[model samples]
Target: MKRRIAVLLAGCMVMTALAGCGSTGGEQKETETGSIENKEVTEKSQDTGESSGAEDTISGEITMWTGTWNDGLMDTLLEGFYEKYPDVKVKFEYLPWDGMEDKYLSALQAGAGPDVLDMAIAWTIPYASMGKLQKLDEYIEKNQIDVSDYYEGAVETLYKDGSYYALPYRSETMCLFYNKDLFEAAGLDPESPPATWEELREDAVKLTSEDVYGFGLCGSNAGNTTAQFYSMMFSKGVSLLNEDMTASAFNTQDGVDAFTFWSNLYLKDNVVPKSVLENDNTTNRNLFAEGKLAMFVSGSYDIDPIMEANPDMNMGFALCPGFEGKTSAAQLGGWNLGMSDTCKNPDAAFALMSYLASPEVSVDFSSTFSSCKSAVDNEKYADEKLKVFIEAINYGVPLPGSPYMNQITDILYNEAQAVLSGSKDAETALADAEASVNKALQN
Candidate 1:
């Protein structure tokens, strides 16, 4: 996918519009700024007659390989989806996170996969490039869907080779998760979390103790590693690739500094876990919940889990810290609703995808920020901690659209592992990674 990445939303602040699709018939209202708003999405909108004849005509069962985040959304979605397209039925298959992507590829490659895939943004292009996903531009256009209603970063995930292959669903951004109780115990102000990289490091040092580590890292998994380190690199005002995506840009001094700082937390500062080189985000989350890790970088998905792990723990959330004079960056991350190239019921599938991805439904489905900006007004996100995540989205940056994204992550993290393990200096490790990733990109 040819994504127009980077800080593309320098001017567009809060999105005033929203969107719905398929047979829904919500009205567009005008905002004070003279912007047309398509924010409402009632299942009964079909009665308003704005729906396409195809939605009114399509029928039969369509399958969706659902993920854990479904959160009972399928029932809620079906009530509306089935109501709009009464003849269409949906079958959902919940898949395990481990090896889920490979399972998806195997099924699609074998031409026996579900009609729809609840895809991650990172998976969209890879699957589309492999001819496993169905193009979505037609469905979006035919349904009068408003693409501009979503965050620019969210919209970028759908485009590949000049066509959209999926529709944005949940939007995500990483943030700082800390223990308020630990902060207070460490003599730091519990009400205020670190807002800058310098402060984060200083406070982490103070919070470190015999039984608790101050901070954590996603040590092993490449994707998890990037979720932490790449976020820091972006906040330091850097990109993994230069403007043209032809070579690695992470060898820059800021990149090295970010990597060095992360490694030092383990090797130099000694404020991270002893197994810092092996922990993934999940491992860190468990540690943090068990009162072993005082702070860590993670997205909203962990909020509930933390509370569940220790109901009495005083956890707090903060925007990811930035440099003194740079934009905070969280890897723009989220899932998208995608269709299989081998779908037997394209119309029914599109209708189902449209209903589920509609702004109204998506907000409920998003564990983090909803891809639809209108969600800011939803009371479900009224909690100050939840709002922190919504605010982070404004600073989020899209991951590179390169097909080598996995390899790029692997090379950078593996080399950084050398630095963390005391086998190499950060600068040298970064340089080697830069060269390795550049070679991967060339292929």
Candidate 2:
């Protein structure tokens, strides 16, 4: 997949006049790293009419599994899908986050899971390794789907080992969410969010008050902590793993500096609350919503929740800040739809996948939820914060799509908590983590 993307990147650079998909309202941008691979298709020109007669006729009962999407929104979107594939029936099996992996594994083992799996991008490699997903490269090429219109971060996450296992339906990247009211109270410009990490610290110190902390940190969960730290590390051009995915690359000077910067905020600067060590994403977001936190980092999805939690809160959003000379990087995440290995109707499954990924349908879907550039061309449905989130994708990078990512995150999380809890310094903790992860990679 990497080699193929390298080729595509070269092609894209030389092929300056390549056809673009979806609405051409905004300028399309490349990812932080110039790699282009197709997974979730971007915009399909409306000229490609629906399949007809015998060849286009795909009929079968295809089951789909997803997390927390509103039934009404899905039904409305699928209405168009059903119109195209009149013979294909879809049964959606909605599941909660709790025990979902176990449920999916058991069902797939018994050959009874849904034909389509709408799952987290992190799960793609693990499930693909388990031989639970169908390879989509052939399908993508045969259909001539152009994924270049999709956010580079979103599409890149589904590519692995020279194949793509899923199509990214939606995408999100982290942004700095701040309380404008708190900034005004602290005599800082409400419109001017921090442009650099040092500025962020200076403003945070000034914004910190007896009742409210300047920053809300969620350092409890291993995954959550690693994700937050990764945004900082990537901004400094520090990768968690080496090129060959053979060992940890995050114990170096840049890695240590990144970790130290975040840790010092909680320890030396005391700009974050002690409970930060116990908090998760939800906790920090809620704290910000309640106006107790002057600034926090979270995804675009948190916009509605924050607004709902505090209707009148003067909230502001901006891209994640980096060092003065460094480029910003936001951690990207979202759901993708994968075909089951045991799917009986491969053609029908592909049809459904393409339908969901189609520009028109994707636009409607993204309208009700956070989505990628390929899905929505304009900010018709987005507010100021959403616009910031969308623009940040140009600097977004997905977490290392290593099969051992879960294990590595576990190690980093534990080491990070140790640093925050004063049990270990950043150097020692990261070094220990590096040794452990390298050992795991060797195994």
> Which pairs in model 1 have colliding backbones?
1-160
How displaced is residue 315 in candidate 2, in Å? 1.6
lDDT score of residue 232 within candidate 1:
80
Per-residue alpha-carbon lDDT of candidate 1 for residues 10-91, written as tens digits (9 for 90 to 100): 1111101110000001222221111111124333444575664555688777778865445345565566565566556667
- Residue 347 shift from truth in candidate 2, angstroms: 0.7
| Per-residue error (Å), model 2, residue 203 | 0.7
Which candidate wins on TM-score? 2
lDDT of 1 at 347: 88
Q: Candidates' TM-scores?
A: 0.81, 0.84
Whole-model Cα lDDT of every candidate shown, in order = 0.73, 0.71
Candidate 1, poorest ten consecutive residues by summed lDDT:
15-24
lDDT of 2 by residue, 1-443 (tens): 24112111100100000011111112333211111111111122123554546533677677777653333456667755655565666776656544566677677667777788876665665566667789999999988877776777777767766888888766666788899989999999999999788899999999998989998777886656776778889899998877666678998899999999989999999899879788887888889898889998876667777889999989888888988799888676666778999999888888888778676666555423334465455545455556777777677777665656667777888989999999999999999999998997776
